[model samples]
Target: MNVPSNRPWPRAAWLTLAGVVVLFFIYWSTVASTVAIWRRSETFAHGFLIFPISAWLIWQRRREIAALTPVPDWRGLILLAVLGLAWLAAEVARVLVIQQLALVAMVPALVFTLLGWRITWAMAFPLAFLLLAVPMGEFLIPPMMEFTADFTVAALRLTGIPVYREGTFFTIPSGNWSVVEGCSGLRYLIASFTLGTLYGYLTYRSLKKRLLFALASIVVPIIANGLRAYMIVMIAHLSDMRLALGVDHYIYGWVFFGVVMLLLFWIGSFWREDERVKPAPPVVEYGWGLPGGLKPMLAASLIIAGFWPAYAAYVEGLAPNNLAVRLQAPAGRNGWRLVAPVTDWRPEYKGMDASLHQTYGKDGRVVGVFLAYYRYQRQDAELINSQNVMVRQKHPVWSNVGEAAQVVELAGRPVTVIETRLRSPHQRLLVWHWNWLNGPFTVNPYWAKFYEARARLLGHWDDAAAIIVYTPYEERPENAARTLQDFLRDMLPALTAKLEQAAET
Candidate 1:
């Protein structure tokens, strides 16, 4: 049979070139957003797995793709454009990068299709790997929470602690230690899975081992977090919530998770066999030396590099800003009275001033708590101590719950508020930072300090003070008052309990 001159060179050569470029571009666009989102939450951080996992899958197919001929099909640009538009629009909408991460996988598919590579059964794994970056783990939260809560409660009970758990939270009889949303293992679960998947893909050469490790990644975090919660509860029970360290639980969870994963990998290696094969040497047929026309491409690359910094700045400016402070209440309204003032006692911090209060409705139902502190500027440990007190107020101490804080800066300096509300039948904790009304600054250092203080508090939610820095606005006194009143109404119980806890501690 005569081969037609019109037919392009063998398929193997083309696919390899196309796949590499497609993979690079898929990762290139997401790099900035990925880093940003990862900084914010575990859900986003785990998204870093997409690249390496995809690379692993691609490596598996290198032999097959290497047999294909190079063919740059322009049709892929249309698919790329559509996907790019979707991602760009989502980014513009201020959607988290993890939400649009699925779009990253489309580039490779579009390239493969354009280059005439048939979609085969073998392509499924790589395609699946691509979707891992998307913020798809939320659906697993309820299940993860349920498991963690169950184990935590069981462990607490086994340790001779009187415990009552419902749904995602539990109550310890000795002190007000409530297992709440922030403690529900959602963040830890996501972080664990993310780390697990990446480690599994990178370390394991066997598919079975990789998949098993991935499963372990998902399961281990939940178990470890449960253990962390159990430990916290056990300590709280032993010492009347004395061990209710606010952020320290998170650190302990991570450490426990690390230990668990190490054990899992050790066990996995005993049964798993390595399956990677060394590649054969490349065969050169037609002589090709940069095609003697690399200048245009090189020039284009250089031009891109030169403008990239400015382009990055422009992109950042376009990125949606979420950390801005927006007060939703009116100030200057003094008619509001504390119906559930929780402040009975003050906890002692070596160098920090702490105050806590709980407000309630006239009906005596718990509203929320107001915990505040003033640590001399740059004195981080005191600031954190204040916040940990607030976090402990929402759990077993009070049946109501949610996360506890929103971070904003007063002026430009870092400040935080521990907010809790009984909007409906549930409690809500919002963590907010109040910047020192001056300029741009970083809160990470303060957060680290806060974590350290919580660890020292040693599982005592009450021993620490709930911290909220109110940013008073001269122009909106009415709004501020209304906001204060509203917040008071919501968090009265938490505040009162925190103050009381402090006194007892």
Candidate 2:
């Protein structure tokens, strides 16, 4: 499959260019969202480089892309249509990550639709590499934190330093150390993985070696990150928390990463094969009917891709305003009476139009019932925003000590709720929370968002609320969870009605 890269050209390049123009408008919102992340998030700031780098990678193979025989594969259109639907669903669900990825996929899909599978296949690596542009990899932080803690604790113990390991915090004879989110080597892992993939593509022709090197890029960084955290802790421990405790910790971590990557590249140089890029061949005229040429393809592509945002726009225009909602506490039930919440600490429920905080007492224990009601759900005011948490990190007086899961009946059905054990200086608490997205109770924030998107798209009321239960625990997590469970069974009926009424009004 070969063709001339220069001169009079083929019909495919012109068609693909038109398709790209249509794509720009179709994915404008997604592009704006991704760009905002690149500007805002320091962690995903590397995403800003991915687009230009991908384009450069493709340009280095310009002759290869241009030389391949392009026969428009309608299969690409089929895939593109399917991806468009998926993107629509993602948009409706308000999952920015999913929608942005689907939008990025249009590049290859358009390539396939206009340039055919052959040309698209030749440029597959660069096309796939475009995914790094989306701001993702935040999910890696938790596991990275755990790995750091495990590695640091093991290293400390091996070095004959007395240590006690907890969840993310560990006690050492010299000082106390905790693996915070910053200590999680996610930034290193993402950078290493991205670089390693590109290096493997440019350096190796063999698939096996490419995969092996790419895997190494992933694996090495994880282990290296763990070791990096361990060394940083050791440096802090040895220096009596003077050296690595400041900005030097960041400097050391990045410096260590750079050295490790340099070493990786040096070793990979042994197996490095050239890209063998070639100049464009002499002009060879080729012609094929574009199934209606560039105009029709552009029109069809615009029609198919533009439908989602068009619908979203129409829906937004017709959506009702419900911002005047007033929230009230449910009536007392099962030997439980409503009382004022007797603490300064309030659950952080962001952008609530209305909220209810009532304390209920049964037997000897006091329970806090909080309902965060929103008349309409939007980006920041959504029921499941991360800002709406039991604790905020700025002051850092309270810490989530542990997680305890248990089954509890809600709305006449058994649902598993994630219970968290929180500890302050003087108080220990067990917290259970779930988002009431119309009806389904979900612990996952994203699922709540998905439900909100679906309901809103269907022209249904998008009113939602979060229900939180707090119970004091003495020494046992089980007792605290049991207290919450009993509280739910007694109060769920009235609570459900109250929430249902919130949506209705």
Candidate 3:
């Protein structure tokens, strides 16, 4: 026989192809959504690169890969089924991050099922590294923004510069500055972490060294970002808003990050341990049947994975898109009466199936009440969405919505809300808003989806709403806050009951 005794190249290749087909069939929805996120979000665009990079990593050691045999690890089938069920749970819960992770993890299970543990061991890092491609870190943005603002303010204070800060807004001697999302330095942090992880695996064999380098990658960028923000302010303050305001510290940040990364790699070079080994060829074994009893495993995975999404689709189909909440003026209380939408700036919840906005007044305190209700939370019409905020980004008078949203005890239950003050040429307004998903208040979009998915799974009506309260406050912020809180005290109990009843009806 003229076969290469060391390699199972021929049999391994066919089964690997088959494994890919089975996994894709099982997880197509997740795959589609993953790609969609990569296309839509600038933050996760690197997702498109993970696949080819993983393949290239595998190709770099083709000989080592070919040396392994198809021993059919049945344990891989068990793990595959477990992950499949997890994916099903995520699908029902509408948690995209969990779903994406489960899909990515299936790659390894598939490899192990088709070619056994030897091939799986050799390719583990590359498979696990694919997880970086998922859009997992957006939850870090709000905290990152807060940290940047605090860091910059401390640095300014150290330099003997007097700065007044509120939420993300700060006033310097030169001008007013707000720590916008772009300035949060999340891009730098994500880039640093991703590159550092890959660098660690490629360059070092010791786990401790890899972990330490990864930690440095995260910490350096965050601290450097705070410094970068400070330097930008200093540059603006020094130039009287001329030079750095135009070119400013954004450019400096990239240059600084580049230098830091280069320095990191160079320093990491000092203790690199090589783990590669040239293994003697394995004795040959031949006969390629359905691998790891994989046909039955694949059938079981498909049944488990496909069930929940199919059920969700059926549930969603039962609800008509045209179904909307019926809203009207709440009964008057303590001299409060519903008036027309008299304010120039109205909070917008576009694409909501139904909504109600009105002005109510009592004893010189005028409050604007808005209720945006949804029969179903899907696509554009939902309670917790970035696009449907109290103030949109493009609003002329209100661009600086506070980074620090507030949590208040409304009627003894904690409700998350954003408190933003909008200033105009002739008037000022104070705003507070929160999302009521099914039963409770939430400021998180992920949780909103999760709650809605749970409702659908449990045969409950998939209903949600947003409550916004704002009023004209020409005086100080404290006065505005007092009036709003008073109005909520009198108004919330009756109004929330009304909203809940509307959802039920």
- Models 1 onward score TM values of 0.46, 0.91, 0.86
Cα RMSD (angstroms) for every candidate in the order listed = 14.9, 3.3, 4.3
C-alpha local distance difference test of each model:
0.47, 0.77, 0.75
lDDT-better candidate, 2 vs 3? 2
TM-score of 3: 0.86
Residue pairs with backbone atoms closer than 3 Å in model 3 (clashes)? none
| Best-fitting candidate, scored by lDDT | 2
Kindly list the per-residue Cα lDDT of model 2 for residues 311-414, writing each as its tens digit: 77776765565487766788788899876665556788888888888899878768898888877676677676557777755346877655545677776777
For model 2, state the Cα shift of residue 13 in Å: 3.1
In terms of lDDT, model 1 sits at 0.47
Work out candidate 3's RMSD over C-alphas: 4.3
lDDT of 1 by residue, 1-505 (tens): 1111122444433543554464445446555555666677655665666667676777767676555433333344445545554444333223334225635555454444333333322355566666666654554554565677778778877877787654455667775444555666777666666666656755776778788888887777777777887776676567655554767656666677678777876776676555566554333222111222223223322233234333333454532232222211222122434453433322223344444433433332223333443322122334432333322334323332333444433333334543333212332222233211111222443443344333322322212333342312234334443554455444433443434444443
Model 1 alpha-carbon drift over 4 Å, by segment: 1-33, 46-65, 71-99, 114-130, 139-143, 158-160, 165-169, 198-212, 239-247, 276-505
Question: How are the candidates ranked when ordered by TM-score, highest leading?
Answer: 2, 3, 1
